[model samples]
Target: MIALVDMNSYFASIEQLDRPEWRGRPLGVTNGRTGTCIITASYEARACGIRTGMRVREARALAPDFIQVPARPYRYAQVSSSIMAALESITPDIEIFSVDEAFLDLTACQKLYRCPVEVVARKIKHCVFEASGLLCSVGVSGDKTTAKWAAKQQKPNGLTIVEPWRVAERLAPVPVTELCGISTGIGRFLAQHGVYLCGDMKQIPISVLAGRFGNLGRRIWLMAQGLDPEPLHREVKAPKTIGHGKVMPPDTRDRQEVDRYLMHMCEKVATRLRRHQLQAGVFSIGLNTRRGWVARKLKTVHPTADSDPLIALARFFLENWWDGVGVHQVHVAALDPHPQACQGELFAPDHARRDRVLAVMDAVNQRYGEFALCRAPLVKRSDMPNVIAPSWKPAGYRNTLEP
Candidate 1:
């Protein structure tokens, strides 16, 4: 059997757990203190029609007393690590789906537990709560897709199980959009083809689905049948790209201020590359402006994981591409990473010294906290938005810097 564990209103729930006063109150967690968008809303806030992605003004309009809490990525990471450790005790066959979700292959461990799958699900909930004092919903079924679907059937603290025989019956009335990979666009397309529900998908031929969605259509058909051939990825996949981006404060475009933020982002990307002991052969920078996105990419002479070169490249890209338009966002990305094995500059002693300095800085920051030892320019800058990427994990390269 496969099981999925999903945290409910993850960021908001963590906020409430850490702050007793915030419990039982309508609250929304924002990306930063000044962030306009709601990252997540507590059940109380949701009850008042507040939701993730709603602007702070909209949330306030819905609930005048709605409390806004800035996200603490470090705190969330710590809690997630503890919860994942608890899960590891259950079975080694597990996939860390995201910072807030995971999938476990329970088939092999069933004999060890010697209990009903439902009992095991309850134990998982109890273990997670004991580890982090947070509630999570669990779904168990014969496959991963069905289990994920079942997990969402209940909210807050819930455990739902779909026996093999009941998969079709239970999923028959559920909308196609409720499945993991089916977005609203795909759902609408399916609806047009009279495949609105899992059961309704039975009418469409696999060939037609394949023709429309390519490989994904066959996967959708299997998901509707509650059969997922996809196996749990016990191994962590190497990240294809390391990047960071930040939204510029509304209507603010001082060149010096933008450069400071850009430098900060490049430093972050470089830190991540070094943390993973990787080097990027390609660099890219982008700006989202009122005129739309302007981006450029450069292939470096050699792979590097150093911040100075990255910052320089970013500035070069911006200088060449940006037309001094009203900027809304800045992005920095390091691509085509390979294991760090760069041959140092033979004649450039300054490059060697700089590398040593960066190593020391990294060590100090890792021991203390993120940005505890940062570039001089970032000293007075306000905190970056505490938005966690959807690809965030409890461990490995994707385990981002804490704030």
Candidate 2:
């Protein structure tokens, strides 16, 4: 069976965990600036109509007793690590979806845990809470879709178990738009017809769903019937491509700033390529333009992740295609090595040292922290947000790749 585990009031719970005085009270983690929206709110505050992404003023007006707190992005990741480590100790079949959610395949673990899903979930919750001082709700089911939806059946430390027989009735009441990938555009189009919910959509012929949604409609129809083929987790394979992009504030472009961003993205993308014991033979630099996106790629003399070669390649593209012009955004993509198929070719003495340097840096970052020994340029730059520009450092933090 698969189980979806979700943390309760993640950001706000961290506050209560660190400061006991906030317990059982209406609390929220608002933006650093006052008058901004509350990014997260506690379960107690939720009862009084407070919720994440709601204005702090509105939340405070809703419940005057609510205490405000600032969001600590790192602390949430730390607590996530503490929880994921506990889960790994229990079972290795974990598919982490976000900081506070994971899908676990407990089939193999059941024999040793010596209980059904309910008991195992309870024990898991207990372990997580003890480790991180936060509560989690769990939903156990036979398939991935049902497991995910069942987890959302009730929340904030709620528990729901759905055996195969219960899946149909349990899911019939939920809306079709609730599926993970349905966009606002698709939902609106579906709503224009009589398809208000998944059950309603199912009553229509499958042919019609397929005709309308292409392949996605067929997948959605199967999901509604709890017949999704996605595994609880997929094994990591050799890297296909390495790339990074940024969501800068709407309309601002300074070439110097773009250069810094390009360097930073290259550092990260190249690091990931090398981390999997592979390298790239070709590099692509992309820029979003006033009217279109421009991408230029070329095969290199050798596979590489070193910053100097990557920077030179990027500069070449910038000089040719980019005139320090109306580029709205920057992206760097490197293509090579489906890791399973890649074999390292013996090269110069530098190849061995470059690999060793990456290893030593990885170990150091693991012990100290990210950007602890960063590229001198990243460290020197005061214009870019420090956390936004991470290096070619593979993060073992929280079991999720940090952005």
Which one wins on TM-score? 1
Estimate, for each residue in 194-243, the C-alpha lDDT of model 2 and write its tens digit.
77676776776768768988888777777776776677643543446667
Which parts of model 2 have CA positions greater than 4 angstroms off? 21-41, 44-75, 88-92, 106-117, 211-216, 227-229, 289-292, 325-329, 337-367, 382-403
Against the reference, the lDDT scores of all candidates come to 0.85, 0.72
Summarize candidate 1's per-residue lDDT along 1-403 as a digit string, tens digits.
9999999999899988888998999999887787778888999999999988999999999999999898887788788889998998888888989889999998999999998888899999998999999999999999999999999888879899999888989899988888999999889889888998899988989888899998888889889988767889877689888888887776557888878878988888889898889988798888888878888888665678888878888778868877677887888888787787656556534467777898999999999977899889999665765556677787787788522
What overall lDDT, based on C-alpha atoms, would model 1 receive against the true structure? 0.85
Task: Report each candidate's C-alpha RMSD, comma-separated, in the order given.
Answer: 1.9, 4.7
Per-candidate TM-score against the hidden true structure: 0.95, 0.77
